[model samples]
Target: MIETHSSSLKTDQMFINLGPQHPSTHGVLRLGITLDGEVIVKAEPDVGYLHRGTEKLCEVRGYHHCVVVTDRWDYVSAMTNNLVFCLAAEKLMGLEIPARANYLRVAMCELNRIASHLLFFGTYGIDIGAFTPFLHAFREREMVLDLFEMVCGARMTYNYIRLGGVMADAPPGWADKTSEFLKYFKTKLREYDDLLSFNPIFLDRTKKVGIITAEQALDWGLSGPNLRGSGVSYDVRKTFPYSIYDKLDFKVCVGEAGSCWDRYYVRMREMAESVKIVEQCLAALPSGDIMAKGVAKIPTPLPGEAYAHVEGARGDLGIYLVSDGTSCPYRLHVRAPSYINLAILQEALVGLRVADMIAVLGSIDIVLGEVDR
Candidate 1:
C-alpha cells in the first residue's frame, strides 16, 4: 500500500469576507479580500451599506433645515459638520458673525474633535484585543458628552452651530466646567500613554505594520491624522484658516514614521493640542450678541456658488453650494474626508496577515456613515 500511492494536490487562492457585520469594521463596511495562506493577496472595500442619499436630501431642504441634515454625515463630530455647512451658507450670503459667536464656535468644534478622537482611541483598543483601554477611553469620552449635552441638549448629533452664529451662547459657568474637563483630561492622557502607548504588545503589533509612504498618502487623498502620520504637515485649519483658528495658537501634530503606530500617535498628540486651543478660546471669549440680526431671514444669494471647508476630526470637511436665487439649494455636494481617506484601504492591506489587516483597518478610523453618504 505504501508503494502504490500516487495522488495530486491542489492549491488555490482563498477569498474571505471581512465585513458588513464584523465588530472591528466600526460600521457597516465590507471588505472582499483574497488571501494566499495567511497573507493578504488583495483587498477590495465594498461601501454604500449605509448610504441615505444625504446630498440629494440636502437639496430638498431649506438652507437652515440643511444644517440638521449635515449632522448625520459625521455623526460623531456633528459640530464640525455644522460648522462647515454654516460657513458655506454664510459665505454665500455675505454675512459676518459676531466675534463672541466665532470664539464659541471654535470652542465647541475643538471639544467635538476631542470626543471623536476618544471614540477612535477606545474602539481602536478593542480592535487590538485590549478591552481595558476601551473602558478608560469611554470614561473620559462621557465627560465630553456631558459638556456637549449641556451646550446643545444633544449628545451625538447637536445641531448647535447655525449660519451667522451659534444657536445660543454658552450658558453660565460653562467655561469653568470646560476648564475642569481639560485639566482632568490632561492627566487622563498621561495615564493612557503609560497604559497602552508604550506597552510592548501594542508596539509589537503596530510599530512597523501597515506603513504608508508620504507620497502614497498624498496620492491616495489621505488627510487628517492619517496623512500627517505619513509625515505630511497639511491641515485644513493651518493651510486654510477658517473662523477664529488663525488667531488661536496651537501646533499641528505630525508623526515621524508612516506606520500604524504613527497614525495612532498623531491623534493622541492632537487631543492635547485641541485642549490648548479650547483653553485659549475660553480665555479670549468676548461678550456680544450670539447671532447676527436678520440672519434667520437671510435670502438666497445672487445666482452663485461657494465652497467652505473646516478641519474636521477626520480631515477636510467641505460643502459646495449652488444657488439659483432660490430658498432651497439648486445643487449641493459634500466633500467628506472619511470617504476620501478610506479609499487607500485596498492598497494598504496588500501583503499583510489577517490579524495585521484588522490592525491596519482600525488605524484608519473610518465611520461608514460619512463614507457611504
Candidate 2:
C-alpha cells in the first residue's frame, strides 16, 4: 500500500522583501519575493525609489539647458545620454555635425562604455563574494575617468557632447594619452580573465546559473549585453550604425549559453571591441569646427517629431522629441534601458535559489538612475 508521509505535506510559502536598501538590488529597487523552501516562487520588482521626473523637466527647459539634465539619467555613462539627446535635437533642427565632431563623439561614448562595463565587472564579482576583482577593475577604471576629466573637467557627469558638435576638441596630447591607455587596458583584460572568468569557483557559480533562452530574452525586450548574452546578435551600432560606427570596424560580441557567465564574458569581450573602435577613431579623426556656425542661443526647430537612439552601455538608449516650432521641446520621452531590462527579473528569479537571485540581478547591470528616471 502506498501512503503519503505526514512530513511530506505541503507547507505555506514564505514571502520576503529583498530591497529598497539591499546592495544586491543594485539601486533603490525593491523586490518582493515568494519562496517555496529555498527556491523562489514569484518575484516582483518595486521601483521608482529614485525617480526624478527627468522627462517632464526636459519640456520646461530650453534646448541647450536640457542637455545638462540628461547627465543624471544613466550617470555611469553620461556621455551616451548627452549624445542621444543632442542627436534628437540636431535631427529636429536639421543640423549637420562635422566629421571631427562625429569621431570625437564616438570616442567619448566608447570610453564611457568601457567605464560602465568595468564597474559592472567589479560589482558583480563583489556580489558573488569575490572582493579582489573589484580592486583590479576599479584600478583600470580610474585611468579612464582621468582621461575624461582632462577634456570635460568632470569625471562622472561630462556634459561634453553638445548639439551639432562637442563642447570642445580633445586637449593637447589627449589622443596620445588615450592610445597609451588602450595599450595598458588590453593587458589588464587578460588579467581579468585569469582572475575571474575561468576561476573554478566563479565558473561553478555563474556558468549555468540564471540561464535564459534567446526567445525568452526577446519576449522580455532585453538588449545590449543582456540580450547579446542570450545569443542575439542585435546591436544598435551594427543595426542602426549611428555616429561614426559605420566608418570604424569592430565585432559584435555574443554568447552561446545565455548564463550569468555568458553575460559577464560578453561585457569583457565588448571592452576589447570598444578599445579597437577608440583606436580607429583617434587614428582617423579629422580637423574641423567643433560646433556648427550661426546656431541661435535658443534656436527653434520646425514643428515635427523625431526619435534618436544610440547603443548605450546598458542597451539602446533612445530619445523622443516633439517640437512645435519653439525653442523648447513640447514633449520629451526617454527610453530608459535599465528600466525595461529590469522587467525580466520576475521571470529569471522564479525557481532560482535566493543566493542565485543576486547573481541573476547583477547580470542585468541596472543603474537605478536610469531605471527610475
Best by lDDT: 2
Cα lDDT for residue 325, model 1? 84
Where does model 1 exceed 4 Å of error?
1-10
Superposition error at 117 for model 2 (Å): 0.3
- Write one digit per residue (lDDT tens) for candidate 1, span 1-373: 4665344434478999987999999999999999987889899999999999988997777899999999999999999999999999888889899999999999999999999999999898889989899999999999999998888899988999998899977889899999999999999999999988888999999999999999999999999999999999999999999998899899999997889999999999999999999999999999999998787564677789999999999998889999898888888899989999888988999999999999999999888889988
Question: Candidate 2 clash total?
Answer: 0
Candidate 2: list runs displaced more than 4 Å. Answer: 1-7
- Per-prediction backbone clash count: 0, 0
In model 1, which residue pairs have backbone atoms overlapping below 3 Å?
Answer: none
Q: Write the per-residue lDDT of candidate 2 for residues 1-373, one digit (tens) a residue.
A: 9987696779889999988999888789999999988999999999999999988998889999899999999999999999999999999998988999999999999999999999999999999999999999999999999999999899988999988899988999999999999999999999999999999999999999999899999999999999999999999999998888887899999999999999999999999999999999999999988888767788799999999999999998999999999888999999989999999999998999999999999999999999998
TM-scores for candidates 1 onward, in order: 0.97, 0.98
